[model samples]
Target chain A: MTLLSALDYASVAVFALTGALVASRAQLDIVGFIFVACLTALGGGTLRDAILNRDMVFWVADPVMLAVAGSAAVTVFFSAHLLESRYRALLWLDACALAVAVPAGVGVAMGMGSAWPIVIVMGMITGCMGGLMRDVVCNEVPLVLKQGELYVTAAFAGAVAAVVAATFGLETGIALLICAAVTVTLRAGSLALGWRLPVYRARPPRNGPRN
Target chain B: MTLLSALDYASVAVFALTGALVASRAQLDIVGFIFVACLTALGGGTLRDAILNRDMVFWVADPVMLAVAGSAAVTVFFSAHLLESRYRALLWLDACALAVAVPAGVGVAMGMGSAWPIVIVMGMITGCMGGLMRDVVCNEVPLVLKQGELYVTAAFAGAVAAVVAATFGLETGIALLICAAVTVTLRAGSLALGWRLPVYRARPPRNGPRN
Candidate 1:
């Protein structure tokens, strides 16, 4: 529980940083910056909870979460101009976010007793969807949907590992550690090796219906 | 059933057309145009069905509905250039969309056995959420949320009327007609009279933690 709590805070902090980066790129005002940051931090979990029909979402249940995310956003907004290395900082923050978030999402879904495949899918979605939404709103091609590092695939692998370890009678704590290790390693490996999914563009159909 | 089908078709068509118009303004390519149109036509229903856990969404179950929406978008995209009064055309199209969509949403929710209040909420959400999403994606402020012509209010009033009439033993067809009429009339009245919701500004917090 302590380890999960730490990872949760790390994930939220990194996500807040990424959100601030996006808002800065868009040249948004302070209000827009906070709005985007909170959205990026809570959006994926909110969708997941809504889909699962949970009684109350994590942010809604605990106001402290919102406060922490908001504070992180404000801190980054004021301090971002002082940073010397921009792209490298953004990349490192995003990688750290993926490392922490994938396992957390998988852990929560597994705790909910979702089927293994569904758990894996949910983890991938939860880990990546918020960033994808932010990119869409920021008018960028979604990084995951483009030829990028194996982001969603890494989440899937981690979630599957966690589920499989649990099926082999591992303790929940041990399983979470394994999940986090798998997620971080796979994602970091992809970043180091420039690993990417194959881009399979749909071929225009012959004699396609005319517009 | 026949009237419901007609209304559904009309709503989907006009909504798709509106989306295509926005896509033009956004300078999206052909694929983006089609995607946005599809999102506008089916997005609300998809959210509703997903929330309700309904099996197989309507467009997924019936591809012809998508075809109709696609054709409507294509027609509007091409014909828009020929219109001398595009803004007027857009206003009328929006009015038509509201008239058809509000009652159709209420009818669908009630048919699926949702309680009165839930049905009313669903109706408003279904009628408004897609356009809100469309505007947000296009980077425009959401018209439904603005202090402008009473879109959600009209939807709510129509849905309540339909549910009340049904509760009082009115025929389903007549009830739907009354609901549709209420929505259309309310929307038309708001546009003519410049009716609007009061503006909402955030109030200063007392004794709140400051960052």
Candidate 2:
């Protein structure tokens, strides 16, 4: 497999595991576990392809991805109860998947000759949107939008790193590696070191309301 | 404007209204209202086009749809508090949007000469997915998936009505009209007459656990 495809598969497997863990927490049936796993594994890339108007979505072009996701769900369904802390496992696995997926998005958008803004947005979307959809569908607040989390910020920084690296005439492979490294570092820092962004604090109006 | 386009616009407006009302209930700011409204208005058609690999997503091809959703959001943001029962208004508006959207989906799929099953699924996706996304994003149980409601069932029956009408050599317009009529009737009945489907009832397993 091409390096990009390998990264895609890795991310899909990791994300599916996280999704199935979430399904377990929700007390869903086996079918629900499989559905959520596939959705989480494929949702981000499907959205990025749709926005870019790719001729076919990634999973549609390669049904093996579905098999990968389903296998992950089945494995998790029977095994999740053994984990003492599924939530912790989900966070770490999701960070790893983000590291892989950000580069995949950057590579695909760059290959498509997308503009820099679109490339950055696609990278973040690929890295974060699957988890967002998973949380929403399962009725949890999205980790991407939770107060003080560095999830989206990390994805953004990673995508910008790729763009900057490419602008400096780096090879595509080298740029993507840098992207993945930057993503994982920031995400790991947030998880392990409590790095965070300042959240909005509501305040009274600075001035009286206009008539 | 074509009949299909008109129906599409109508659905977008009504769906946006429901989305904005939901945003009010969520206590989000004006920007949040606009975001949710646009998401609810455009989400379903976007999903349909993406699945079909359409050359351009509907809103991307015609940017005016965004303006329509935005207008609806702004209007509701300013007036939602005046409603005696925002939830009731949301339900009725959502039902109206569903009626128009089902026909739009059937028309687009039929125009592409899709097979009957795809047409039916596309119709349901178009009619129901926007509201599902709206509810999910706003952290509410999805109305589409709620037990006993005729939401998805109504969309299915409507799409089947369209397919059946077309199989009898009816014109596209007539077929879509039948689709809309059936969808609205079922949805309205569910809303006003307490019509419902049988929901699953959990029962203790008769057979003992197997090794």
Candidate 3:
């Protein structure tokens, strides 16, 4: 199998694990776990393909991806109770998934010869949107949208790195490697070293009831 | 200028109003209002077009739909406080939008010569997904999934009505009209007359911590 496909599978598995962990936290049934896992694993890529108007969505083209996600969900459904800290596991697994997914998105856009902006946006979307959707659907504040997190910033920087590397005529595989490395490094830094961004601190409305 | 286009515009506008009202309740700024409005208005159609592999997303092709959503957001930004019960307004407006949107989805699927099941699913997705996204994003239990509510059932029944009408040699326009009428009547009955479907009542797990 191609390295790219391997990375895609890895990301799907990890993201599905995180999603099923979340479903466990929500106390969902096995069917709910599978549904959430598949949704979280496939949501970002699906949206990217849709926006790019790909001939077929990735999972639709290869049902094995769906199987991978479902397997992850089933595994987590039985094993999640043993985890002492599912949230921490979710965060770290999500970072790893994001690292791989950003490169996947960049590669697809680059393959399609999309403009730099579109390439960058697609990478961020692919890396971030699945988690965002999972959080939103599960009624949690999205990690990507959390104040002071470097999650989106990391994805953006990684995508930009890929674009810049490609602009300089770097090999496609090397550029994607650089993208993944940068993404994971920054995400890891945020998780382990407390890296942060400035957060919006809204002032009280001058003349309205507070929401 | 066609009746279909008119209905599409009406749905977008009303859905945008509901989204903006949600934003108001969420205490978001003007930009947030516009973002939520556009997302809520265009999200379902975007997913529909993507799944159907349309040449372009509806708002991307028309652009005017985005403008309509944005305008609704701006208007609601200044005026939402005037409503005594924003939630009530949201429910009614959402029902109206669902009525229009289901027919739009059915029309698109029928135009593509999709099978009956696809037609029913596409109609339900287009009518129900936007509101589901909105509520999920805002951290509310999704109205579509609310216990005993007829929201999804109404969309499903409406789509089936359209398919059955068309199969019986009805004109396309008349079939969609029937779709809209059925959707609105069922949704309105649920709202006004407390019509309902049986809800899942989960028994306590034989052995697990209460979620």
Candidate 4:
């Protein structure tokens, strides 16, 4: 298998694991676990494909991706309790998944001869949207929207790197490596250092008697 | 435009209004209103089209839908304060949107020569997913999954009716009318009568200490 394909499977597996961990937290059933996992693993790509008007959704075209995601969910369902620092593990696993997914999307968009803007947006969407969907379905605040760290920003930087590399006619493997490295470094640094964007702190006052 | 096309735009308008109401309650900016409104108006059809691998997203291909949705949101943003029973308006509006959307999706799927199962699923998804995504993004419990109504159940029944009618070689317009009638009857009846499904009241507790 090509290195890119290997990265795709690995990305799916880790993201699915993180999703199953959230399902376990919510005390959902096995079906819920699989649903959440698949959503986390494939939802971004589905949206990207839809926006790009692709002929087939990636997972629909390849059952192997779905199988990998489901297997990851099942494994995590049974084994999540074995870890003490499970939440931490889930976050780190998600970071790795994001790093891989950005390049996967960038590569695909470049292969399709899409514009640079589309390439960057698709890469960021692929990297961040899975977690966004997972958090939304789990009925939690989406981490990407939260004040915690520069999550989507990391994806943006990586995507920009990849897109610029493609514009310069660089090798796909080199572009992928550059993206993965930048994303991982920024994301991991944020986690370690508690870096965060400024949050909206003020709320609009409620209309009352207006007396 | 056909009757079906008119219903589609009407559905988008009402759903977008509800989405903007949610954004108003959340005290979000105008961008948030437009974002949520567009998502609510077009999310279901987007998902249906994606699953069927259609050539284009409905709203993306037809800028009219997005314009209608955005205009509805802008109107709601200015006028919601004049209404005392805004939530009630939102629910009734959602019911109407569901009625229109179920037939819209069923018609599209049948035109595509999809199987009965796909038609039914696409219909239901088209009817309910806009609200589902709206609620999820707004950080509210999705109404379709709530125990306080027969939301998705109504969509399912309508979809089934449409599919069964098509199997008998019914006219497309007739089949669509049947679907809208069933969905509106069931959904509106529940709202009028306070009908609700039995909710699961108990949660399975985690293993001791969950350690």
In candidate 2, residue B115 scores what lDDT?
Answer: 95
Query: For each candidate, what TM-score against the reference?
Result: 0.56, 0.62, 0.61, 0.61
Better of 1 and 2 by lDDT: 2
Best by DockQ: 3
lDDT of each model, Cα atoms only?
A: 0.71, 0.87, 0.86, 0.82
What is the fnat value (0 to 1) for candidate 3? Answer: 0.11
Superposed model 2: Cα runs more than 4 Å off: A1-46, A55-128, A137-139, A143-211, B202-211
Candidate 3 residue lDDT tens string, B88-199: 8889999999999999998888999999999999999899998887887766678898889899999999999999999999999999999999999999999999999887
Residue B156 lDDT, candidate 3, scale 0-100: 96
Task: Give per-residue CA lDDT, model 4, range A21-51, as digits (tens).
Answer: 8777765545456657887998888788878
1 versus 3: better lDDT goes to: 3
Per-residue lDDT of model 3, residues A1-211, tens digit only:
9767887888789889989988998999999999999999999998888888888889999999999999999999999889899999999999999999999988888888877867876787799889888998898777775546678778988999999999999998999999999999999998999987543233354564433
lDDT by residue (tens digit), candidate 4, B3-109: 77876888898889989988888898888999999999999998888788887888878999989999999998889999888888888888998999999988888
Interface RMSD over true interface Cα atoms for each candidate: 12.0, 8.2, 5.9, 6.3
**Residues forming the 10-long window of minimal summed lDDT in candidate 3 chain A:** A197-206
lDDT (Cα, 0-100) at B50 in candidate 2: 82
What RMSD does model 4 have? 7.8
DockQ scores of all models, one per candidate: 0.05, 0.08, 0.11, 0.10
The CAPRI class of candidate 1 is incorrect
Among residues 3 or more apart in sequence or in different chains, the pairs in candidate 3 whose N, CA or C atoms overlap within 3 Å are: none
Candidate 2, A85: how far from true, in Å?
Answer: 15
The local lDDT score (0 to 100) that residue B52 gets in candidate 3 is 94
Q: Model 1 reproduces what portion of true contacts? A: 0.03
